[model samples]
Target: MVPERRRLLSRRWFYLLLLLPGLLFALPLAEEDLNAIRSVTDFYGQRAGKRMQAWRELIQRGKQQQWDEKRALTEVNRFFNQMKFLSDVVLWGKNDYWASPMEFIGAGGGDCEDYSIAKYFSLLELGLNDEKLRMVYVKSLTYQQFHMVVAYYPTPAAIPLILDNIDVAIKPATQRKDLVPVFSFNGSHLWLMKERGQGQLAGSSSRLTLWNDLRSRFSSEKLKRPKLNLDD
Candidate 1:
């Protein structure tokens, strides 16, 4: 190969090399758990058809992307949002039930929070930075109801990208004028989203009863693959 072509190829390989450790760091899931997820999704695909196929494809896509953040976010967002938007009342007979990624895809239906939660974890599994991702609580002026969506901040000060089940297209927070952000959280810290870079620490995430419960369930489902985070 030409010297310039060789240098370019070397840089590409170097970047992929750097991506490897982060991918391992991001996926705390156990081998058995990953296998179990694969098996269950396989069964769903065979028996339930399209819904199950979507789940399987999501897993495959995550693995194939090899820690490409932009592609991972776009694919994961698209995968879960495609599911039918059924309320927790209709799906779980409760006003609110935070379904794990497995449970959400298994049922093939869920509300807005479910979509955001599933997308967050799936992106994490694909090695996207957890710091860049948040589950945002918002009030939907259009529907006049409390809602949830995933927000991706490429930089600390960049306008967040909104990943919503209700909207098929990914949009910047500025464009989504109809929805107002109240607060945001992830596996780490909960923030009082009053202004940019001015988030006050709310409290230990354990205070979020349902969020704590959901993370516990995720740990169990993943066969106790080491606690991700429980406190600051």
Candidate 2:
């Protein structure tokens, strides 16, 4: 091979490797999930179909390819942030409602908490460790309302990266001056956060009554997954 062509091929191979995490083959989806998406289309129409199809592809591709953590964060944030923002009252006829990833996509939109919860689950499905992710509840000073966002903690004591639908740009927690974090939780524990960092443990995530109800709905209402958040 010519020197130039050899280097070009090498560079191309390197880029290809970046997209391949482990398995080159795509993951299989259950028939019931496919039926569920069709039902969503029947009720919610083509727009919902589009959202559900895209979400399905995102999970399948993320699972199929070996996406680096940064790529996982970027794609998941971008995918969910595209969802239209709707209040719980407007979307679910409630003061506060938490939707599963399927419900969030099927409805074609949701509140901040929905965005965060969806992103958190998507990453988890892609094989990201639960320890590295949190559903954070913060006060959005910009909007003067309680909000929810997903935070990626690279290390236990590391300054976490904020995955917020409101800002739509993943930045370190220190850079998000407009949000004052009140608390954070994952599938395991909950913490009351101080300004920019995690605080003392409050309790297990099961203590959040809404989250418990949401977990049950994730089974009867949507696709089954290991039982499992808020707005952004």
Candidate that scores best on TM-score: 2
Note the Cα lDDT for every prediction shown.
0.70, 0.78
Q: List, residue by residue over 92-130, the lDDT tens digit for candidate 2.
A: 778888988888876657889889989998899888999
Q: What is the TM-score of each candidate against the true structure?
A: 0.73, 0.80
Off by over 4 Å in 1: 1-34, 37-57, 195-198, 222-232
User: What would you estimate as the lDDT of candidate 2?
Assistant: 0.78
Give lDDT tens digits, candidate 1, residues 1-232: 9998896676455434433444544544456656655654454442223343345455554686574777777777766765667878767778888988767766656789889998988888777788898898889999999999999989877888889988879988888988877778888878877753326779665668889989988887642111111000
